[model samples]
Target: MPGTRTNPLRRLLVGRVQGVLNNRASGETPVVRSAHALYPPDSVIWRVHGDVTTMMIGGVTALLLQMLHPAALAGVWDHSTFRSDMLGRLRRTARFIAVTTYGERAAAEAAIEKVRSVHLGVNGVLPDGTPYAASDPKLLAWVHVCEVIGFLDAWIRYGERGMSLADQDTYVAQAGLVATALGCDPVPQTRAEAEALVAAFRPALTANARTREVARMVLTQPAPSLGFAPVQRMLMHAAVDLMPPWAKDLHGLHPSAIEVPVVRAGTMAIAQSLQWAFAGRATPRD
Candidate 1:
């Protein structure tokens, strides 16, 4: 049974559809090409970029909705002074991302450790089967830097109007750290190296089997109620409206725009597939 605290509509709004859509294209592309022609290097990079973009967009959209409707966030945004609290949270998140130096082994290790502690399973498996130990500050720093890049991309694509110049600089710095951790020059310097770095690290950046399992469980399990039924309904309505026409048709319902749903779904599927690969897994569960 659905948990009494869970909002069915909200669950549907932020459902597996998002993950499936984000990772679909790239996951399928190789198969499609294997049956026909060799997948071009350019195509692979494009697929990764596309998936990354989709993730940022989805995160941004969810963040915005949460901000607009505190109750929908399931206690993440339920304080009496939610807006101020949220601002503090965003600032801290940004600062965390802004501090890392690129290509620093210490930084990367530090970042990775921090991420492991959260155990969101986004990184898949650690180098060893053991839970990530935060002993190395460098790994933690690098991971934090990469996350900042992800968040920055999301901000530019979806929250550009609200971002400041400081945010852009911070993102650039984080990107530099990502480049450094991957053993590339501070910048890719050339398209080939850029492609190579991306190819090499793509597997490490996404959700792994363990992480996906965690996400799936979190999504499927019901959360406690916070008395925001109307707000939750509104978010659902907005998410549905944001879906593409193809999705609308698939779900047998019309939404605000058909294009967003279609693009978003396709993008998400690819992203999730990449995540699985990074985690060193064969494929994600349907």
Candidate 2:
């Protein structure tokens, strides 16, 4: 009540109601409901939904800026930190996917090594282990290319922000080379071909239930407990806050809405499960 004197009762009431409405809207709205239907009701759904929503809102904001103040937006895009953060996030996510999906630790290590072997290869380091050699520029290029492919997949499949026809082609070209370098074939040209490729890889994944379980666990974890969540949140907030005021007004996405602590918790649990499946004891803390 003391603080309420300055805040004003009317404004407080309105803010509280808006918060409730937003929460309900996020959960039960058509888009979110459709997302839940598309993804089995699981932690993966929550994580993906949150990510796509954030990206969509962010993309819209960027598009608005491009329309209203193209020069300003271009400047922001050209900022070194923006590129560094994006590359770092992609590299980290790619390593996680590679390690979990392949279930071949040595191959993952080798792939990272190959990326580092190239010139101008920054942001190609493994998340869990120290690099065996100095980062190679070529290796960094390969990693970034692979990440572009992954990002495109997420964008297309999940409706993430900022994906254009041009971006898709760029991803395809980069991914093709990266795949070839890794002795993996390029992604199929068509969606059908992609499906076939996925099916072909399905057996390997299924054969090792442990890997699938680990991936599932990671997918379900909440953000706060994840090693990367804090950093990710900070970046997300900064990106959102940097958008023009009108863009923020249009989207009405408060930064707090994107916060997901559960993701980290789920990842930790899954990591522990992976250890057990691999004949190792769960960590004492787990």
Q: What's the number of clashes in each of the models?
A: 45, 24
Residues 163-212 of candidate 1 have per-residue lDDT tens digits of 55554554454355444543333343333333344344433443234333
Model 2: lowest-lDDT 10 consecutive positions:
277-286
Q: What are the per-residue Cα lDDT tens digits for candidate 2 across 56-88? A: 223322323222222222222333243334333
Q: What is the C-alpha RMSD of each candidate to the true structure, in Å?
A: 19.5, 21.5
The TM-scores of all predictions, comma-separated, are 0.30, 0.28
Residue 176, candidate 2: alpha-carbon lDDT: 50
Q: Residue 198 lDDT in model 1? A: 36
